[model samples]
Target: MSTSAPASLTGRTVLVANPSADLYGSDRMMLEAVRGLLKQNSRVIATCSRTGPLVDRLQELGVTVHITEVPVIRKSMLSPRGMLNLARIVMSTFPRMRRLIGAARADIVIANTLTLPFWTLAARSCRRPIIVYVHEAESSLSRAARTLLTAPLGLADGVVFNSETSRIACKAQALERRGKVRVVLNGVQGPATSRPPRDHIEGPARLLFVGRLSPRKGPDLIIDAAALLRSMGIAVTVDLVGDVFPGYEWYEDQLRARVRELHLEGVVRFRGFQSPVWEAIDGADMMIVPSRGDESFGNVVIESLLSARPVIVADHTGLREAASGFESAVRVAPDDPKAVADAVRRVLEDWGHFRAVAMVEAVVAQARLGTDRFHEGFGRAVEELDR
Candidate 1:
């Protein structure tokens, strides 16, 4: 990796490819990166497989978004039918991608996630420098699946990792060891300094969980912990403030059923998909990130801290890195409702102390995770490719 400062991106035309059209953590970060690139006076053309809210959002940000036939390579792609589907999509989409790149005359191509290897193929044909921003930790992937995901990384001119945990995971795969790998931590626009503190301490301790209500995000575990807290005679209310993915509506249905089965209908409220998530975070006494699966990075964890609310996260993957250096934030074993319940109880028991610590820590964390710094680091990493 080069130690030189980032070269300017002025007048550069860059093409960005993202796997999903949803506004999840990775998608949101990609948008942020594009915004940063635009600020540098670079023209950006973004491509994705599907069309949804993210496409509209990008257009609003002055980005030209193209809905391409690029197949999203996932674990399913390992299956026989999936492999055939992938082959068909790649064969069909390759010519179109080549035309798009030629028309745009892109100076650099950025593939937002590891799942989108098609970008590498397209960029290579155009002879453009490529950057792969890896936001996933393959700890949960099967050996064959992980190989499929990491193999194409070697073809890139540069790779950007959202967290050190993700960087380490990629290194362990032994893929593209020679490429310039840089850890560019995800950034969030933190709340203002004069924001009001959470005041609901005397009555029910309002706990909040914000993320996609999926199995990996552990919305069910949050509900389970809420039940455990109630059974322990703790007065607590959990606000689950995010919706499930399109095909994963069944998981949301299961969560609602679990709330009823545990008789926690009153305690766990499903507040679907709150924008400016700080609004939800601000109303909580403390935040809980009970992720059952390995998280490459925990954006919500940082958001909670920036909101001056202490967070209790699962002690696994990049979440551990997110919660590091903050005494107010607590980490418990992943998938353990008992551990989550205990951590919640501990926060509530010393609510004032934890709240004070959070308020102080928020200032520090906000300075460290600002958008300017993130963009500067990201631009520098990309600029290194030009160097």
Candidate 2:
């Protein structure tokens, strides 16, 4: 009962302004969007703040890459000095962005995330149709802070919320009323075939936590949960996959120190960030997404489900939205190591039942949250802007 994707954009050009060049959840989503546009014969020009693997991939795909400094709004940039720096970056890059859009004769512009508010304004000044892709659901933020972040979406011709949670958190009801909003739940592709969950729960249970190693993502919580599980005579080895941001090295250090403090030296391993995380997910019996803060949607949770792996997620925001209705998925209280431990314990006790359920859910997830759906939804968003 779904409508077809819009017609081809043969003669149109798209300019995608993304905040980072890293291959994280949002960054990977951006890549898929670019691919979808190319399939429709739209010329794509991508702009990244810094150079990384994503930029390389774009060029390899024959998409023009424009390296520029993109002003990203973060919690650290809320102070006077931070605000001043943001202002300076805006002053320097705004005109250049507008000029790039005009020079490329871009018919449409897409700001990959709300972090790049400057891109929205630049596209507006260029008189190009712009779509803002909202990826974060900051229910934890103060109302004013949320407003400041979402204010630039006013200039966008269309707003694409990755999930309904994101739309509500951004207070985009007004935009929805104007028919400028589309909630396109992320479409993620897993391995070519679903990997079955481990047959036998022998030795220690393999637990995997994948995401940015930040306080909000709660890598520390995984360590605590592992410690608790071990204390209860449960043999478990925890693998913390993913890395920290440039300035958040301290968080990683704190995690290692906590592991040492808990004397979980050999039990806990830091795998850093792994691209194409299928092998890691396949190796683990279960995956955990313990975000202590707001998430627009749970790409990792979907990945785990698609891999036929049971997932233990913090029950709130998009995590709940993603993990709900699947028997293989377990929800625990956010920021509570005991809750995580208990959930893991329960799953271990009934491993056979959970694994069977995971195999079934993998097929359902593939049909519902697969890459094809994502590409079609992304195409529809652009087509709506064309109207």
Candidate 3:
């Protein structure tokens, strides 16, 4: 992506408030947003709750970093105990966030996700333009919950949703009424050199799943599908390529237990979170993203397409948006092991045709979902908000 400074961002200080310092999907997108601002010659200041891989990456990019604790709301926080913890975080961090925004003298404040309403509240108090990049679509939540989660958008000067699915689910009608919403598709980095799908298959068709091993992400479904595929006499090896969040270890244990229960322990391999996942993508014959829960957008789906690898993704929400109009990406019913297995079987049966289509679709994905487009969209949003 070109770094030439957009007129609005030139020499302007942009404060970025991200909840986590991990290099996951939303975290990585936040990194891309920072990259775009830096390329445009804008001064960037980034604040995260703690230091992790993302902080290191931001430091490498020369962004001024502050380890500032901030309140990050989650679904679990709907309960009494969770509410108390959230209250404690807000009480402890809101003043710091307000002070940081003032000290930075940021022309505009960018909050990476809606989870951090405290940042928006702080930016509002500082009289800085605020942009909250919405990477979530919590339609599954109760109406009251959705209202509570999105109430912070009322304070934002601009609200950028990663997908239309997210935009609609967020119910940002107030923002919409004010013409403050933009749906910027998530930008993904693909392999540097796109290769055709392997021509000769000498062994079991290698299948890969690349996301958190959480029940929501449905890593266990891959195991179930593998067992189903085996029963159908289709040879395959399943690789689950990401780890769970801190509290989701139980889900991982359940996945392993299921593998043992099915007696396919040897057929499934647990590959912990691998960065620059192009290697795993290259090694696998095909990919499956069977998310059973809400996904704002499926970056992995786009990555698979860009690498010329066929993918099977859930047909709902942003996953559908990401893989739409691409025949190379097979959309299966969410949380269905049989559907996943059938999709895998279809690809293997017509491997040659799907492989060729994958190459063609890769070019289209590059044109439509490339990093440049991602950068351009955010740059435009900033310019509009500044005006």
Clashes of each: 0, 0, 1
Candidate 3 lDDT over 25-119, as tens digits, reads 99999999998777678899999988898998999999989999776788978655776678776887788888898899899899999888888
**In candidate 2, which residue pairs clash?**
none
Ranking of all predicted structures according to TM-score, beginning with the best and ending with the worst: 3, 2, 1
TM per prediction? 0.94, 0.96, 0.97
Give the clashing pairs for model 3. Answer: 5-40
lDDT of 1: 0.84
Model 1 misplaced stretches (Cα beyond 4 Å): 1-8, 79-81, 172-179, 192-194
In model 1, the clashing pairs are none
Give residue 157's lDDT in candidate 2 (0 to 100).
90
Ranking according to lDDT, highest score first: 3, 2, 1
State, as a TM-score between 0 and 1, how close model 1 is to the true structure: 0.94
As a whole number from 0 to 100, the lDDT of residue 311 in candidate 3 is: 98
Instruction: Supply candidate 2's per-residue lDDT for 376.
Output: 75
Which window of 10 residues has the lowest lDDT sum in candidate 2? Answer: 1-10
